[model samples]
Target: MSINTNQFPADGNISGLPDVTELEKLANELFSLLPNEMPKANFSPDLADHPRLEKSLNLVHDRLPSLFSKGEGFNLNNPQTSLPDPHFPVNKTPQSGFGVSPPAVRPGNELSLNRPVSPNSITTNTDYPGLDHKQPSVAGSGISPSAAHQGNAVNLEDPQTSFPDPNVGSSVGLGHVPHSVAGSGISPSVIQNGPGYAEAFPFSPDTPFEPDFNKLWSSINTFKSTPQIPEIPGTGGAQYYFLQGAGFKGNDPFGINQNPTSQLSGKTFSHIQNGAGHAPFDVNLIKKDFPILQERVNGRPLIWLDNAATTQKPKSVIDRITYFYEHENSNIHRAAHELAARATDAYESARSKVQVFLNAGSVNEIIFVRGATEAINLVAKTWGEQNLNAGDEIIVSNLEHHANIVPWQQLAAKKGLKLRVIPVDDDGQILLDEYAKLLNPKTKLVSFTQVSNALGTVTPAKQIVEMAHQAGAKVLVDGAQSVSHLRSDVRALNCDWFVFSGHKVFGPTGIGVLYGKEDLLNETQPWQGGGNMIQDVTFEHTKFHDAPNRFEAGTGNIADAVGLGAAIDYVNKIGIDVIHQYEHYLLVYATNLMKDIPGLRLIGTAPDKASVLSFVFEGYKTEEVGAALNNEGIAVRSGHHCAQPILRRFGVETTVRPSLAFYNTCSDVDILVETLYRLRGAHR
Candidate 1:
């Protein structure tokens, strides 16, 4: 259905929402795709065989012939007099609604948000706004299925229906999904691209996010012959998109292939779904590379899900570290020995790797620091201190990690500059309209996270950077959480500085990278001074080396830097796009399974999130949930997550967060869900 977006009013009150039949078809298709039964290792070809999975799914929804909205409460209806679900608590107190209207239609080519919103445009606060901040429980509805699936301006998770909106936040408003889904329904190439996704979407991002339809079934159970495509899963039932070619093929029964590392064995993934003559991603093979995934916890296979805190090292990274200590260990750029040359070469090679990874301008622009924290401090003391003056202001998003927030706060206090924040919507997404409102002549810098560690929100980095640049302000993107999960390009984002930690990206703990634009880095002074950083020294003064060298004040984490290079190599060998697609599968499978638990509240439900699931279960503390999952050999984070602001914005002090990485498998997610279901039964 081709939507004429111009038909909508200036207030963003959508009119002429035509194609009712099409909406119903899409909704029914969505329900059909949800797993009726999660198959075992040697699974059935029929998707309709599992009664247990269906029952588990029904725990949150009322069973009926065909599901729909009930009286006085819409499965899809008006919100003012809607009834609330008994199982989940609703926040009755209404506050100011946060919303964003679609981009205004301008015939001209050039459009910049620096100018005020056109009177013909819609703004989130003024146009079609959303309801309360809280996420309501899915309640039993008795309305007609046809009426319910009209896909109205009603909450999909309306405290009376278990159905979740693929696009909107907890409450309903309206927005469009990224426009990339205009091709072959489930193409990984377009879907797995870096996140610049706009706010809310009314339906599945794809007009039809279906499995490939072709003569693809010829090679059933022949994993060697079949070339598989990985997908960045669409919301709840995204995992099913990982199906090979046209239909379900008998593949890895373990939910992991015997060998996943050769995913991009030869060809490119530009034609990801057409059996592009490349080997499919094999999770089991990738698992073998990480020896620690073999360790048993409490006599059970350890399923690591706390990837937001740190990633487990692969054998290659470990061996690379060891290889450096045994053969190439020496202080860099100080002595003229063989080991020194090797050490310098390895360290610089890592720098070069980071430069290429981020698509940075040059190796000289990459500076090594203790981690993202120190990297932020380096910028705060050097660039911020030198440029920002009293009365100047810095803008940060409400989704910032404390590492991004605290340094700017300290700098603002020291320089007597005011700090402003861009607010978020019911979903954890930053309100682009609100962010635009905060920019002004006083704004000197804008810093925010590329991905929220606690929420898994993939913010609009490129758009945000472009906005800041338009306002005549520099931007810093904290990529500690994003680098590992997505393909972050520094040049494309065009931020003044981008920071990330090595450990977060499967590298050593102490080493991290700070990438600056070439001209910008040369213009700024170094924050530290030491032996190798000085060109010549005198009692009166000393001449400092250029950007990277001047910034390296003392002995750095030499060996770990080399390991970081190796880690980059390993990731490169198994394509970042492949990792993104695989992790998305894990995230969606886990989300669909967990949504069945009666009182589980998923905190961050952004349409464009990364691999993080943050939730709070009723009648149990987050700690209790974490402990329960831990007992089952599944690790998750259960605390404030160093992101108190965003959590508090959602009115929770803590949440049980399960994050993902490429090496993770569907089996791991299955174990996590089964354990959670057990906990739910115990509560009952």
Candidate 2:
């Protein structure tokens, strides 16, 4: 008789072979029991017919010869006689009239049904019975044989084999199967492996077979969600931790936590205070601090006129560096060792010293760099890169040293920025009107030197800084020359940034200070990446540290920094006002004496000048003048002074430069002037 595809009796009886879904569910349950590493069959169950099922079983037997023997065949046409009872124990012997042998089973071991069976052939649970007794019944629900077989098919060649689902009208692969069985609320693998299966399978009347997709997606979304990052407090703009207690509303004008006098750590400024109050500065007492003054050059007592090049270190500064290396020698921060703690305290203390010296509001505003060159380059690469766009203008002065000039030039060249220069008058002073003309909406940054290194011109620094601010431009004052001679009050100047080298201020070399406004430093990104500068680092991303730490990447010159602190202490003790007055008196005395010589021409004669004295003697090369001065125990620089543009502007390749300092006396100036006069006569 032809099979009826859709006829059912009132008792829920169906006549022919079970449909695809029931067979697939049974096959999935069976396959899930196997270990994941077991090789899976690749055959499709939809193609399984009585004839093909027999052929597939034969193929499994052929491939795994030791597992299945040839004699264990069964006939699907008479399953009632050949199959064992559905409810009775499977270990019981079969009754007579059976045409098939029982499925092979090893004692105390679960059955391995690695081959597929035709749906019609499996009429009862016991028909293929070596499944663990503890396992859940695949057919336990009121599902009749016909219902269990409906819509399900088993691929005999492979349990993982995929087949088209007639109910869904599409193919679903084994890998795509839902992790938990539909309606059962149990994992597919758990259902097939043993004990818990009986309770997990056979859906109750209240539970439907449909999967709850909404709940599944909700769990996935929770797993993939990102955590919210906490905002750092006190920064006026974006949320970031303020370094050195800056960026918060406070009564202190400079934003420092402690008073400037308190930060001095009990160091006395009495001498400086007395001198500023018109007490005469003891030149002998001041000269006692510089040990290098005692050295003889070419058998003559040394007269140092190279202060503009680099100042000699004071005894206090040298002692401070030696003490650091001897007692507090260790890398700063992130260590539990005693030396590290001391080193870190000393380094940060030095930073506070710089902050106080510059009259900067916070210690975070000060970044320790190698020298003035690196400080300018850092700002150029970090702030310049972020702010400068094509056609933007950067203003520099004709009085700028190469440290202040070259970095902007390179940045302007790379970023297509316009570099505008404020011209200087014949006296080497920056023309205020010309500088005002350079100020415009296009000016992003105005970088100029407070005191010209090549010449003695002292620009109107506070006025220039105010103009730049009015024009909506940030200003950087190169304080390399002026910081030693004049008091640097960054708050009063209102410049966005100021830079100076420690070596120029009677401190150690390889150390400098970059003082920026707290808000500006917070806005600028770090130009380098390495240890200490970063808070966290990964192959994919890096989070940087705040302000000073962000810019100071690796191990800094710790000993030198402490020495710079000592130098600041020295300057404060002696007083910058006293130094300025005494140096001015010496400059006038030297100028008058040198001008009396007929062949000498002073190169830079600005009235408001500091310590620099640039000149050219008639019929004598600049280098020859320097050598003659050296023979008389006077040391002067003879070069472009790294201000080539300014030197070339004056129509000269180089000049004989004798820059003075407070340590230089009237006697030193007299000897230098007399030596220049003798050299001029010899040339004539």
Best by TM-score: 1
Output the lDDT of residue 678, model 2. Answer: 77
Q: Which tens-of-lDDT digit does each residue in 14-131 have in candidate 1?
A: 3433233433444344355444434323223443456533442343133211111221111111111111211111222211111101111111211121222121113342211332
Candidate 1 wrongly placed segments (more than 4 Å):
1-223, 227-278
lDDT of 1 at 556: 88
TM-score of 2: 0.60
TM-scores of all candidate predictions against the true structure: 0.63, 0.60
274 in model 2: Cα distance from truth in Å? 4.3
